[model samples]
Target: MDVDFTFRKPIDVSVILSTLLDAGMRSSTEGREVAYLVDEDGMFEWRTAAEYQLNEVMRELGDPRWNDRVVGMTLFFAEAETGGDFLFHPGRESMSCVVGINPKLFQGSSRFCDIGWYLANLVPLLEPLGLSEIEARDSP
Candidate 1:
């Protein structure tokens, strides 16, 4: 399906990223995982991960249900070396989206691919749900 990522405002991508990380970490299934992304030039860069800052922000966000939810259905780490459009799929619960927080990886496989998948798909959904965009200071 053709997924829509329209947003009301320009959200600080980093903040949303950190929130996902915090939620993932708090769940305890994964201690810490960094989201990876592929740039225009096909370069890999590290995005955000579960860290002290994300935890603090999560605490401030103060939504137990939000943390509990996976935001989307199935999140995975994928690398399209050939370069193609992002793939969007359905999840068991509501929906699924992937975010490439980190840069693209040209060589070998990306270890942070899991987080990358989440960021690429979920970030756009944040605004519609009444979530505020990250501020300048919050963005990395």
Candidate 2:
């Protein structure tokens, strides 16, 4: 179920950024399913036509809820822009390609408490992608 495997290498960050950007662009235009990868370090990076940085992604595999349940790791998604800045966003349907775990986990919770738990963990984990901090709309 792993979408793709991203080993830590010199191009690891750029590779991830490019894939996601390409996928996002395709989704924005031609409508295609996106593919991404994460390493054990929680480096959630992707790519498309350009490189991006996802140093801030969280690691859900280590969570108590998933200690034995989920394998692999968590990663953040990001994109680079023309201005040399990066933009991070909550992973949308497009950025996420699921594997190993139940896809249902991604669906929003009906219970307010469950939703709160989901976002609380998700926010800090995803903060490193720095989506909220960067306005990478210019596109890389």
Candidate 3:
């Protein structure tokens, strides 16, 4: 099974990334994407976050949870490697979007992936700037 979340607006990818790092969540520090089609050769090799800050990672190993929920499904592939058509599934426009946040956002993934943490943290963290209210979903 696969899971993902969606936002009402375009979020600051940087903030999310920095937040993940700060919260100590772990994903892939590298992905397979082209930051700018013209800047580099059209190659989809494993590239570090620095290679494409355009979207997503850092480096660590931890499953953050909130209120007995898992923040992420824990995939070995990089976010960019997810697919070119982000949030878009085959023959569909909505894909399982993976927005990796730090485990701290969920108050540590030791067990639960709680929404409360998002309310307490993500809200104040983004609401002020109007970047909150992302909904999570589970898909097969």
Cand. 3 Cα-lDDT: 0.32
Model 1 over residues 1-140: C-alpha lDDT tens digits? 11234334433333544544444422222445423332223333334445444444334333333432223211223233211122211221122233333434324654423334434545544555444333211111
Best by TM-score: 3
TM-score of each: 0.29, 0.21, 0.30
Worst 10-residue stretch by lDDT in candidate 3?
58-67
Candidate 3 has a TM-score of: 0.30
Q: Which should have the higher lDDT, number 2 or number 3?
A: 3
**Who is ahead in TM-score, 2 or 3?**
3
Error of 1 at 44 (Å): 6.7
Q: Rate the local accuracy (lDDT) of all candidates.
A: 0.33, 0.27, 0.32
Superposed by TM-score, candidate 2 places the C-alpha of residue 112 at a distance from the truth, in angstroms, of 8.1
Ranking by lDDT: 1, 3, 2
